[model samples]
Target: EDLWVEIQANTFKNWVNEHLRESGMQVTDFHDDFCDGTYLCALVEGLQKRPLKPSWNKRPANQHHYLENATTALNAIEADGVKLVNIGNVDIVNGNVKLIL
Candidate 1:
């Protein structure tokens, strides 16, 4: 489905380019595909270069969530001064996530 949407966007872009030629304007091809929906085509906001405010920027719950997580992390350090100090490989076993420490 994501691929389909991107294909649609490309098709729409081509159609617009052809129309531009009719107006005596030369265009050297263009691609307009954004499956992330961060962009919109002619009728959509993306094609017009209109930016969407990130969802996280609007949701109060998400803001609270990060705040809570930060506080928890601080508390962990305060209690034990222990923390994961490295980015290491993660493995899954028996449907459980195990991290290499």
Candidate 2:
């Protein structure tokens, strides 16, 4: 069960990375947060609900901007495909410093 959970988490993380790359958004550092299988599940489900958008900012001042833009894109993803799933209490703090899931 543990290995299966890990596999699922890794797959979800890879999907997130791929989506962020395709959208020209930098993947936010979730730090140790990735160790929590439930958190990864939540992140994946949240992202699926709203896919990341491509960056439109021509002159982002910093990496923070990229993350912000990516977040905006994620929130803007259309709600047509997979049905949205709800995971509890996932928070990104300090403007990408840490993710508490």
1-101 per-residue lDDT for model 1 (tens digits): 65765576457557655544433433232221111111112112222233222221112244344333333333333344555443211111111111211
Using alpha carbons, what is the TM-score of model 1?
A: 0.23
Please give me the total number of clashing residue pairs in predicted model 2: 1
* Tens-digit per-residue lDDT, 1-101, candidate 2: 65765565566557766655534543444544332222333344455654234423434455555445434433443333533334212233132222221
Instruction: Check candidate 2 and list the clashing pairs.
Output: 53-73
**What is the Å distance of residue 26 in model 1 from its true position?**
7.4
> What lDDT would each prediction earn against the true structure?
0.30, 0.41
Highest lDDT model number:
2
- Residue 30 lDDT (model 1): 25
**Candidate 2 has what TM-score?**
0.33
For model 2 the local lDDT of residue 78 reads 32
Query: In every candidate, how many clashes are there?
Result: 3, 1
Worst 10 residues of 2 by lDDT: 92-101
